[model samples]
Target: MSIPFGHQQLHNRYCFEGKLELVTALRISSGRASDETDAPFIRAFDGAPYIPGSSLRGAIRSEVERVLASMGKEVGLISCTLFEKDACAEKARKFLQKIETEKVKKDAGSNKQKNELTAEFAKLELCDVCKLLGSTVYASRLVIEDALPVDVAIARNHIRIRDGVGIDRDTGSAKDGAKFDYEVIDPINSSITFLFKMTAENVTDDSDRKLINLILGLLKHGLHVGGKRTGGLGKIKLKETDNAFYKVSGFENSTSLWKAIVNGEKIHNSIEWQEVIKC
Candidate 1:
């Protein structure tokens, strides 16, 4: 007898690899006061700040969910395929029934069966109904680790909203000239670190190019990040021997991707495909 086997082993191997990272942008307003509720109710900091790990994870999951929905695969599944092979087992049986009815010699019988079966098949063939489910299921497999700040920006032109008003009328004018910063640390290897020092926005070609140049600068100067904890803040150091890859930008703004292409720069907004350098 011939053996019939599936690719379960190969699937298992491919399933365990990590493939994505999500970053959430964080903002802390300066020149403002608290509401006793501990909520940051001040205009102290300017513009939206760096994103935290938790926020990044939430955003990632949300984005993944959105992508899944857009692709028609938003089903909630706990393991493996979003739908079990058995989910449509009964549908298969129904399909067979329709086929058999089509073979009937009576035109009325065939017509009746065809109409009824068409309606039933519509339910099964709908990708929209089941795609979201599949997407949710697939997204669940995504391993989300704690968010580490990659970069933060305090926009120069950004206005602080105080008591629901713009900066001009507010006590503080976001003009303290905001500072942008991000964290890149070695999760696996502590010895290697890279500090992606990003400056406040300046007049540049495109937002993407500005970001790319900033990142490239960070990488270029990142070699000096180990054993040099000046402020005790965590930082990552890029090394000569590292395999790093920029991921696609997943921000609400899709136009930023053009910066990289237009300038032949390596600035990426997407964090999913980024390859962390091994220390």
Candidate 2:
């Protein structure tokens, strides 16, 4: 992943590694049913329910957008929800066209210089949220790994059933033949904990760093994932103890960062590497 700004190669890596406890039942579905049930929870190939990285990324992106839409508006942190027609990116393209036209007229700058200028302008056009969580125009700054139960045996035993019925709005009654049941894990209360790890690249900007800290704060305070959020399922929080954010900076090139990434080394807690920072 790049720094959510441009497609430049990443030279640095920062990792947030920890355990996340399931405070409530989770019911993210596989969208297919087994012979014994109308719905089933999503599971890894090992037959244990695992939360996909894509799902976690989507949820965090939504939360980041929500925060940016509220806190970033005053500072020009635009939120473009439009698909491919995001206005800011479009405007940037148009502006780049003008710059290209002017450059051609002046016969100024080498091809490399022109390309660098275009990239800078494009980067400037991105909003803070787009710069942090990413949009259609750019790749995200970080990646999350799929969350799996630390103790698979415990997870296997936690599957539970929940019955749901569709209601008719007009009659305020249960719709005929609309009752269904689905599978959930550790529905009421849970002792289930999953591994949580996120890796971000080339986050040097203060605003980008602050956004990263804010995301951690949100996770620390807790956030709900999976389905049935309105019904209070999928409430998860970072385990405060032993959680760590590693700012593995001071590297000179991508080679060292790649080595650090592969090793998954946990550095000591110091003035630099704090455990969990407030937003």
lDDT of 1 by residue, 1-279 (tens): 221111111111111111122111123333334443222412213432332333333433333334434432223221122355633334445665766666664545555555455444533442322211222111111222332233323122221222222243365664354432322222332122112222211111222232233333343343122112343322323233335422233322224445555777655333332222211
RMSD of each: 20.3, 6.2
Per-residue CA lDDT of model 2 for 1-279, tens digit only, reads: 334445466665576677888888888888998876778989999898888888887777777777766776554445665455756667666776787788889988687766566557657777666666664435677778999988888877898878878677899999998877888888354578888878777764556666677678778777888888778888888776634422333343466656656787533221243333323
Measured against the true structure, the TM-scores of the candidates, in listed sequence, are 0.23, 0.73
Worst ten-residue run, lDDT, model 2? 266-275
Q: Judged by lDDT, which candidate is best?
A: 2
Report the Cα lDDT for residue 152, model 2. 85
Provide the overall lDDT of each model, using Cα atoms, as 2-decimal numbers: 0.30, 0.70
Per-residue lDDT of 77 in model 2: 46
